[model samples]
Target: MEKKQFLYMLKLVPELLDEKNWTERETAIIGEHFCALEKLIEEDKLIMAGRTQNKDDTTFGIAILQVDTEEEARYLMENDPAVAKKVMTAELFPYKVALYNPRFTI
Candidate 1:
């Protein structure tokens, strides 16, 4: 219940690989981590997460997450598959989430 939010910038490699080159094993491992993260969100351990289509070319995606503390947040980042494979980089920045803004049509 310590409510801390962060902006996660996930940087993907520039060299785009074919489906075969991507490797199923690596993809599966990353998928597994994502699945676990989804569960944590559902349980309120993670308030929310957001990522978008690959537009930045090098950036795989970006996300926003609300977790209990800075330690837990860093733990998640350190253990990410992207880091394990060294195919992507994650940089986290502390942010104050702007919620319930009537102007944005939320």
Candidate 2:
């Protein structure tokens, strides 16, 4: 099955987790998101996701998400625990993407 693709940009705030005194709860929260997000990806609902790895680890300086539509973007963003608890804030906008196949070169 072929699915539509849409690009979205999301920014995160470090909150207390990125602090020097971070707690296990914070780690668990992030881990939970990772697991949930992976499930979405495996199902092909999530096309792509990227985040910045800053030295300070102040959360993703900026993150990008690829979904199907603006509505889907909004729903996914809202569902993210990062946004649910102010750990991150999502600034979403629909965008177009181009895919390339580098496998067949002649």
Candidate 3:
């Protein structure tokens, strides 16, 4: 099947920005979130994933994926540990990568 690109943006629950609200469970789920993204990268399903440095309401994260269908893309986004467990919420959108610099790394 041919693949299409999609992007999912994630926003943290307002309380998450305050370190006082972090419990072991929230920390573990975040760890799982990173692991999930790593797995996607290894499988070639993820093009890139990152977040803003700010800790305010404006802060957000994004993951760009290449998948066979929107349903698959939604599945991936909805299943992200942070999203699944409600540590964060996400919105999906069809996306196109208009330009990229091969040497850029972060």
Candidate 4:
């Protein structure tokens, strides 16, 4: 049997992100968010997570995950310190990986 999965798009709260810099407080909160994601990665719940490098207001983060359902995905996103703290918001979507390195396949 195969496992179900979904792709989640996490957008940084534009207002929270300084175009030029992040406050000490913002940095700490972001750090906690990263740590939370790292925990998910270590647990194998998250497949890949990264942020866009556009350096513009549209920049945001992305995470591909293998989970049972959208509800589960939302649960994970809601628990992220970034989201819970209003530092970021997320949009969930169904995704299919058409191509990838074989070694990285589940």
Top candidate when judged by TM-score against the true structure = 3
Candidate 1 lDDT, tens digit per residue, 1-106? 5689876677656553334456776687668668866776786655555566545554355556677787777777766676656766788788776775557531
Candidate that beats the other on lDDT, 3 or 4, i.e. the better one: 3
The parts of candidate 1 lying over 4 Å away from their true place are: 16-20, 55-58, 100-106
My TM-score estimates for the predictions, one after another, are: 0.70, 0.68, 0.96, 0.83
* Backbone clashes, each candidate: 0, 0, 0, 0
Pairs in steric clash, model 3 = none
Alpha-carbon deviation at 25 in model 2, angstroms: 1.5
Model 2 alpha-carbon miss at residue 87, Å: 1.7
Candidate 2 segments whose C-alpha is farther than 4 A from its true place: 1-4, 56-68, 100-106
In the predicted model 4, the residue pairs found to clash are none
| Tens digits of lDDT, candidate 2, 4-89 | 55554445465553476456766777777777678777766675576766645454533345555667767877787766756566
Better of 2 and 4 by lDDT: 4
Which has the better TM-score: candidate 1, or candidate 3? Answer: 3
Q: Per-residue lDDT for 66 in model 4?
A: 80
Question: What is the C-alpha local distance difference test score of each model?
Answer: 0.67, 0.62, 0.96, 0.80
What TM-score does candidate 4 get on C-alpha atoms? 0.83
- Candidate RMSDs in Å, in order, are 3.5, 4.6, 0.8, 2.9
User: Positional deviation of 56 in candidate 4, in angstroms?
Assistant: 1.3
